[model samples]
Target: MKTKELLFGACLCMFTACNMPEKGMDVDVYEALDYCDAQVQRTLTELKAAEGTIDYSMMPRNIMDSLNTWHCRKATKDEWCSGFWPGVLWYDYEYTGKATIKEEAEKFTEPLKFLSQIPAYDHDLGFLIFCSYGNGYRLTHNPEYKQVILDTADSLATLFRPRVGTILSWPRNIEMFGGHNTIMDNMINLEMLFWAAKNGGNPYLADIAVSHADKTMKYQFRPDYTSYHVAVYDTLTGDFIKGVTHQGYADNTMWARGQAWAIYGYTVVYRETLDPRYLDFVQKVTDVYLERLPEDYVPYWDFDDPNIPNVPRDASAASVTASALLELSTYLPGKKGEEYKNAAIKMLASLSSDKYQCGKSKPAFLLHSTGHLPNNSEIDAAIIYADYYYIEALVRLKNLIENKAVI
Candidate 1:
């Protein structure tokens, strides 16, 4: 683990210029942290300036994609992305210990109280509760936050069907046509269940999480370790219906974010359970991702899409994969760990560069994240989750350098 910090110090001595690192090399840790701090300060100033014009009733939201302008658009608490803005604030508070940021985090968190009471939370409870209240409890040790997370876990557990051995991702009535659908994205939500079960919610919740992962490992992936976006199941018999890609280029194509989710999800599963199979799976899938990624370490919206150089890049996928790789590197032994860490370092460097990092003119930090390309939605735009994961990766890197707990 000390290798990451040592590498940073070594790079400092090798380079004459402090801010500049050779292309594909890791930037100095101090410079990276300064970049994060500057981004946070700029975003906070913008948020405050927009206070009078933006609605606080549904406070935190994404800066909608625009041609030459950016503005926050309100989303309901149940919306999958609603928790990320507050999560960003919490990350800022965690990194800087700034009281104003913590106050703002609480302000945005207040609006999400209703999510815990919603009976049908689908598969996004982790993104909704864990990212916000979960991190809040971790930092503040607040009993109320703990209770909210537990209740949200309980709400999420209702979506699990024993026959399917997985949680339902979307409601059956939703336009997406699967009766008992389970998406690779749902795997990301299992962390909250694991946390709740370990923290006195219910031991069965942990069992549910493990079962879901096991089933996903069996069904959602291709022979090459790439993943399908969706796995439809027979609600009555728990049989597989079809493996499809809803947000990808085509059914056979590998959606960039789906692969990112698999990498992050399995790394998390290994963290929670110390399961060897999960680690093996992560290594295999991450190998494919690293091999397929372009020279800069960012990937196109879909890996299998025939359009190569002209395709839109998904910064969100790169950010998520980098964060996961940082944690995964810690768990690997010797040179393998260093390899993953270095790759992640390269990713952070590329992302921090002007090519992807949003300028002060934009409301968001990371830019060029394709939310759903096939749907003609949010393509090559700034996304909230991208910023959240980028900040999380930077803080996690800082924590590792300081010999602190990462998650």
Candidate 2:
């Protein structure tokens, strides 16, 4: 009887230990502890340096507007680009376990909600709701945050054009129809819908989400495996436009960010559907992306365009690509999956190797981010999203290797 009780206790201990995640694989978490500590120290130093809180709002609105205009400014606060950092910071808090980032993130979230209150529902609401409210719910299990996610998902579903069989990019402005029938980054929103179905028991959201993926595979993807940033279709006639361009070189050029979206987006689709098309899309895109990557393992902002002399490289794009590759690797088969996993691992390694990364004390960030054209204010600054995704990729890799998951 004594021997049996001891044996049972030992087995229980082993089972509990097996369920816990292993340490040391998550380098970003360790690094971020130091980084966020340094940031908190510096921010406190700056606060001390300021004699008083200077009222920037007292300055004329024209000056404030002019200051903002010199950069890649979005027309509205609710557009997708505006939500990127909030999402990234949300990830940062999860990785680092720092309360300061969460506090700063809360400050950022209030303004986003203020903007969303006018409630311009579009393709990007998922970005905001998922990052701000969804993440908040994940961390705090706050019912208010969960409601925010549900309401935002409802807003997003309304943007679905039954004609195009996908969500419209813009809900209020018809002029912003560049993304009319385009199934680009909007695919990422499916996760929000999928969560809705599972959590709120709304299967309609999940059904439409999968249907959108199918429609995207049919229309936006090219034979060469490239994806369109904006696949404009006639809202009235439902006809295809031969070529289109939004932020890239031509309508045909593969914008690196859009490719990142497809790579990650399709992987999410595969997770739910287990549909072969999503898997095929992942394989084809990863193959092309890996082939075209620069010697540093980071890619240019646009994969198809020739390298312009002295043009800035987009580290943010590289970060996004790395993140997507990490996610896509999980769905691949056998040795093929290992290859994809190795490629993502290589990219993350190269990013951390100092050739492409920022030095430790700028305090602004730690990635080589590029934005807009040369004339833009944020043209070559290290962006927060780059840091966010780079850390996310590292954490994801840690999870896969340590968990002994197939990827």
Candidate 3:
């Protein structure tokens, strides 16, 4: 597929940039990657200078301060975002082939190995290990990274309940949620299971991944295919209880990131399994999400948010779904493939523009991501995963332009 990223995107036609392909994509993929290379190194240097000493526990999470510098919300990562920093480094290394970037990638990645030694501390092990070590191994063929990924996959599998047919998202929340809880976010983590299962980890890891996907597909989405952020199940009966949201606007609302996960997760499942079932299902999910987007193709943090134009926009959602669509496009034929690819190009264009690109204000790639509005935390911030997925999508786009697979 061609990148279709040349010529001009008129400033006057900014809102319609995605549709005006004759104007071309607003940003060039290589140019964006070059921007990422500078920003990643600068962010790391700034992060280290601010830190004074290297603390493996603390990773860059967001830009929430008055100075517009990246900061970690926690002293350590109990949150799911820690892996994204290293993951960004690894993707940068993959794109640039700079030995310095690769060396930096290894430095950031190796510290995450502790994630493998622990019991499943909820279902975030995949985000922690796979994004960091998984990418490290994929690029470097480091046997040690492979062992860690395998060990961490096994660690993550402990959360899978045979009765629930899905991984328990938060064990601590079981009593609060009143059942075996699985979140839509958990779908993205299954890639580690699928990868590990085929690559020297327990073979059942793939079964576990498939089982989780199948079960999530059954219970997590609404009849219209819009998804809830969380799905609670009866622990004893293995029956679905209700669909809800933790980070979304309301219980009945379609959380933007949650639905993005559905789009992305199912695409990955289809890639690994080549199942027409997931292919059809993901297209439905993608269509609904695409249909509801704002003029720029970026989504409000929640599709059902009553505020509409007043709400925070989530660049992270757009970037993640864009990356997924690039891969998903490769799997289809004819007009549908072109449609998805064009939609993704539009998203990258919007994200790459001055409206969202972080520029000089913050060291990260894009801005205006809502982490949890309800919790009043990191609202409209420059989040690490947003940068991770944004760069990942750029890398994928470059790969596609060169007639290569996104993987």
Best by lDDT: 3
Alpha-carbon shift of residue 340 in model 1 (angstroms) = 0.9
Checking candidate 3 for backbone clashes, the offending pairs are: none
For candidate 2, write residues 288-384 as lDDT tens digits: 7778877766667767666653555667677777777776766665678667766765666666655655444344334455554423534455565
Tell me each candidate's TM-score: 0.91, 0.78, 0.93
For model 1, the stretches where C-alpha displacement exceeds 4 angstroms are 1-24, 48-54, 59-70, 75-77, 173-175
lDDT of 3 by residue, 1-407 (tens): 13334323343245334322345544588888999998987887786756475555568898863548878643233767878888999999898899988977888777777778877788888888888998999998999999999999998899999998999999999999899999999999999999998999899999999999999999899889999899999999899999999999998889999999999999999999998999999999999999999999999999988889998999999999999999999898778987898899899999999999888888899988888889998898899989999999988887776567778
Each model's lDDT comes to: 0.83, 0.62, 0.87
Roughly what TM-score does model 2 have, to 2 decimal places? Answer: 0.78
- Candidate numbers, best lDDT first, in rank order: 3, 1, 2
Q: Compute the lDDT of residue 377 as modeled in candidate 1.
A: 83
Superposed by TM-score, candidate 1 places the C-alpha of residue 204 at a distance from the truth, in angstroms, of: 0.4
Q: What is candidate 3's CA lDDT for residue 210? A: 96
Can you list the residue pairs that collide in candidate 1?
Answer: none
